[model samples]
Target chain A: MKNLVLASTSTLHGQEYLEYLLPLIKSHFRDCSKILFIPYARPGGISHEDYTATAGKAFEKAGLQVHGIHEFDSPHEAVKQADGFFTGGGNTFLLVQQLYRNDLLPALKEAINKGVAYLGTSAGTNIAGLSMKTTNDMPIVYPPSFNTLGIVPFNINPHYLDPDPASTHKGETRETRIREFHSHNPQPVVGLREGSWLEVKGKNIKLKGDLTARIFEAGKEAFEVEPETLLNDLN
Target chain B: MKNLVLASTSTLHGQEYLEYLLPLIKSHFRDCSKILFIPYARPGGISHEDYTATAGKAFEKAGLQVHGIHEFDSPHEAVKQADGFFTGGGNTFLLVQQLYRNDLLPALKEAINKGVAYLGTSAGTNIAGLSMKTTNDMPIVYPPSFNTLGIVPFNINPHYLDPDPASTHKGETRETRIREFHSHNPQPVVGLREGSWLEVKGKNIKLKGDLTARIFEAGKEAFEVEPETLLNDLN
Candidate 1:
């Protein structure tokens, strides 16, 4: 059975890293002693060692050892053999680019599909989708393709923020950007609010967290799905 | 000599479309009776005809005729023969992709470098840079390439926003995002605020408008440049 946790953001406002999701993460990786962390996204351009250490500290609280995947000679082999996969949040373009560069997409996909527990936060959650077209990150780097691991059927819009009606900025709102994504791609997109996560246990993908998720599909008005709703049936 | 107006946005808060910059736009295109409008950016998903009509109305205020580039059989030929070019703002990726598809990048670049009056707002302004990698727009569409006009030596981050000091959003700030961009790309980037525009008169590109512009270099600290400052000297 496929086992995965895709979270919108790693930290909520005023919360520590992985603080809110720690309990769920501890339970999700209960059986594993170690989790491989992919730090290629490099949030704020942090080093892989530093980013991995950050993950290491959080996972230590959960009593699990964390290792940076970049330390291994063969990232592909590491994914194939690891007991778990933990891709942190940062730039999705850079993450996808490295995954392709190291030829780790297929191996990671196969590993997760074959039951290796997977945890993705922010950029990590984005790669679990069919494509990274709905990401809110800047195009700081150009990836080889917008495609990602289709571990889940639909796409994800992570760190999903609703339009600030009070905002006077002329930049397109998050809703407008997602709407434009539908203009080019018909795939369903889930705007997972901060603190939201999708718990994929085999075919049952339930929306976790206290807040509701906004779902948008081509040709249909966007609607909100409740916290406990299952998202497996979404097209 | 390059004669181009690269604006941060088409409209400012509480103002009509191109209202604040209409005077400069009219005078820039003083020798032209008609301007070819590029609407592939499609702000808010407006159609080419509709977006062009919006531009037509604004230009009509300046006693000039307007034509949508899509109306012409050969968009390339249209750019080559046009007295002026106007690329509206929307999605930078979509604009770059359409330019490549219609093979209009070269023509537009050549015409602008040849001293034809050019006006670009938002996405249009983004394409005036060395590459689209610094764009603040969402990656709603994957363009064939991130390369752009390079009419100006540096990249442009249009609609440059200062982080809200009072907000609690944990997502990376605009400054943080641009720093990450420098981590990957060493090119210089200019942050064009909402009310700012870059006036490219021959070899000198000066920052225009009432607001100051932010200048970001690959390794140096980001600093502010006052209005009327010549940007050609920036690295």
Candidate 2:
């Protein structure tokens, strides 16, 4: 069965990287001895090797060995052979650009569909949905397309935040941005807040974590979904 | 001479639409009686007519007539005939998409280069730079390209925000986002804080308003420039 853990962020406030998701990671990839890391996202513009090592240290705590896809002679071959995968978050534009340049998206999608364990955080989580249009990241680079894995029927707005009642910043709020997305896209969107994640087992998709997620469907008012709510057929 | 006012935002905190810029607007377009408005950004998904009306109401206070480009039978013709222009803030992706869809970019650039007075706020201001790569707006839609007018030598980060010392949000800060853009793009970026603007006269560009603007040059530490500082040769 297909299995995945798509999280809003790799770290919560005042927490170590992937610290909150370690327990879930250990259980999700229990069957796999090795996990391949896609470090194209490169948070803070860190080197691919450095990003991979960060992921490796975290996965090691769960008794799993991790290798970066960049280390392989062929990224496509790396995706095909890996039993588990993790894509760290950074600039979605850069991540998408690198993935397209390497022609690794197809193999990665196929591997996930074939039941290889997968974990995505932030930009990584944003790509698991219908499109990357709902992402909050800046357009640091131009990708060939906005299409992604579409492992889920809907899109994801990771690092989703509620509007501050006191502040007066003029930038579009997260909710406004998602509604703007609906102006051009028909896909539904899930606003996943920090410390929350989606757990997918086969065709079943459930909200995992204690917080409630905001849901945006075209032509309908945005509403909240409680934890453990099934979201596989959100559309 | 070429004249333009590119502001970080049209509205300031607790201020009416364009309230903070009325005097500047009056002096900037003193030579023209009518202004052609580009309402493609459509803040909050407002209709072009309504957004144009909003601009009209604001510009009327300065004794200037305003009409939306959408109201014209040919947006291209509208750009060519208008002596002054204003592109309101909205989603940059949507604005760029509509401009490209109507094949209006070249004409618009030509008109501006010919010294037609122009005003841009937020997303509109972002397009006056080398590219739309530094905008903070969500990618609600995919544009054909990230390229913009190149009326200026650098990119503008409109409504530029400082990182909140108290907030725990994990989303990339404005500075981090711009640095990431530098990773792929070579253009310098100006972080125009709220209420600050750039005044372009012929070949000269100067920072205006009470606040200092942050300047980011690739491979160098970001620094702040005082108000009224010359910005035309930032690179």
TM-score for each candidate, following the candidate numbering: 0.99, 0.99
Kept native contacts, as fractions per model, are 0.70, 0.80
Stretch of 10 with least lDDT, candidate 2 chain A: A27-36
Q: How displaced is residue A169 in candidate 2, in Å?
A: 1.0
What's the distance in Å from true for residue A55, model 2?
0.8
By summed lDDT, which 10 consecutive residues of candidate 1 chain A come out lowest? A27-36
Model 1 CA lDDT for position A9: 94
Tell me, what's the RMSD of every candidate? Answer: 0.9, 0.9
lDDT of 1 by residue, A156-233 (tens): 999998899888889999889888888888899999999899999999999999999999998899999999999988
Tens-digit lDDT track for model 2 on B138-199? 89888999999999999999999998999899988888898888878898999999999999
Over 4 Å off in model 2, which ranges? none
Candidate 1 residue runs with Cα over 4 Å from true position: none
lDDT of 1 at A233: 88
